[model samples]
Target: MTITSSPWVHPEPSQSQLHLDVVPENVLHALAAGESASFVPRFVSPYLAGPECLSLWRMRSGQIVDTPTDAPWITRLMVDPRVTAPVGVAGFHGAPDDTGMVEVGYRVDPLLRRRGYARRSLETLLAVAQGHPDVRTVRASISPENTASRALVSSYGFVETGEQWDEEDGLEIIFEVSAG
Candidate 1:
């Protein structure tokens, strides 16, 4: 139950319900092929299986630059380490940008929601963000209509900074919390 030591990747500490494993594109490939690995996803996550996740995988696969193995930061699978059953996907939109801002996103499986899994998973991710020296702020964009999401982040000290209209997500209330 040891976590990886990569700076950009974090495996959740034992206290968390699900292990937050930083999933690289290559690992995603293995999962997609039904191949085995220590972190291979055991449960099918609609968010992970959707086109958005596939597009992220494809994008990461193409950006084979000098970025650290964990720099992509596009996806992670939350799994029960004992049984290796994936509960959801959570990750940053990308690594911290020039402004030292990184967007966080998470989706817990419908069957697993309301059980505190999302909170634990997000807490783990937030720690990772705060640990990174480059991260000044961790951002979350929740649709005004999504009360659950707003509550989840607000509990973590995130405050509404503003709003934005996204083509796919429509109007979203942008929130942020200092990474420190």
Candidate 2:
């Protein structure tokens, strides 16, 4: 099903509490000061202080980094409903490429996994991508050993396309979900 027409795309008033705040280019500095450049820190997760986040922020578009909320794709903190702590991080690699393909990625805190946050966040991300006319496909690259991840995306209509090798991630199985 297309994200736009998916029931999970739109969260109910209560479940809509999760917010996606774009991580700025200097996210490390922002997080150090308890913020995300443009917004105050809603929650703090250990991932925010890791090199992974720094790397992701560095790859962000300068223009989008300046005006984070407007970024087509960037790492974001997934604030819990209580609004006092971060549940996880979620985002895309960037805007759609020339081939209209965009990569979707996310990671929920280990303690918070299996509670449906990843699925919800993914649905929301898909909706955001579907909103853009240029995004025709959403790709997810999962490690061969990550059965949970492979199963997760597959449940949402993502089909295995092929595989590729990465220096860091090793062998990865590529999955693609086409826009409807």
Candidate 3:
């Protein structure tokens, strides 16, 4: 399902809302305010520090999830950088299966704990995901022990699918939200 034929595409946001073009400036201000870190491995994975990592971390492109199957309609969650402090990021993954399904995985900035940024970011990303014609479902994989993250997604209509996994990061909970 190419984006061109997808019913999800729509007009951009209002000037008041944060969008891609405003991210870099927002991030720079957030860094200066000490509200968030630029790109620390302790907060993110060391593997995310490469050139591609910077692009992903900055939300400059939709490259957060790179797979041959994810060539189209995959987008990064944009942050206000200045106001957001980027405590977390919403990473989107998708494929061209014509089912309009996408997945969002995220992480938060450790310093800006309990500020509801993750929830807000996820909400915004979900709205964007729903606007795409090829995105009928959005999914997420959360660490079971991460109570805050679990609560955030669950509150926004995501439901656990009884799926669990033991990755290098320990237990993970899979959640999904329908586009409708």
Writing each residue's lDDT as its tens digit, candidate 1 over 38-148 gives 553454455556554565555444543445544447566777655446777777777778998989988776777897777887787788787778889999999999999
lDDT of 2 by residue, 1-180 (tens): 222221223344456656555443455345544455354445455555545455544445443646644353655667656645567777777667789898888887776789877877887787777777888999999999999889999998999999999776799999999865
Per lDDT, the best of the predicted structures is 1
Question: What stretches of model 2 exceed 4 Å from their correct place?
Answer: 1-16, 24-43, 51-70
Query: Each prediction's Cα RMSD?
Result: 4.7, 5.3, 8.2
Order the candidates by lDDT, highest first: 1, 2, 3
Residue-wise C-alpha lDDT for candidate 3, range 1-180, written one tens digit per residue: 233212221134442243221223343333324344455432333223333345443333333223434433343333444553333445465452467667776554455556655655666667767666767888878787888878888998999986666544567888988976
Better of 2 and 3 by lDDT: 2
TM of each candidate vs. truth: 0.75, 0.75, 0.58
- The all-Cα superposition gives candidate 1 an RMSD in Å to the true structure of 4.7
How accurate locally is residue 85 in candidate 3, as Cα lDDT from 0 to 100?
32
Question: Which lDDT values do the candidates have, in the order given?
Answer: 0.70, 0.68, 0.52
lDDT of 3: 0.52
> For residue 139, what is the lDDT in candidate 3?
80
| Steric collisions counted per model | 0, 0, 12
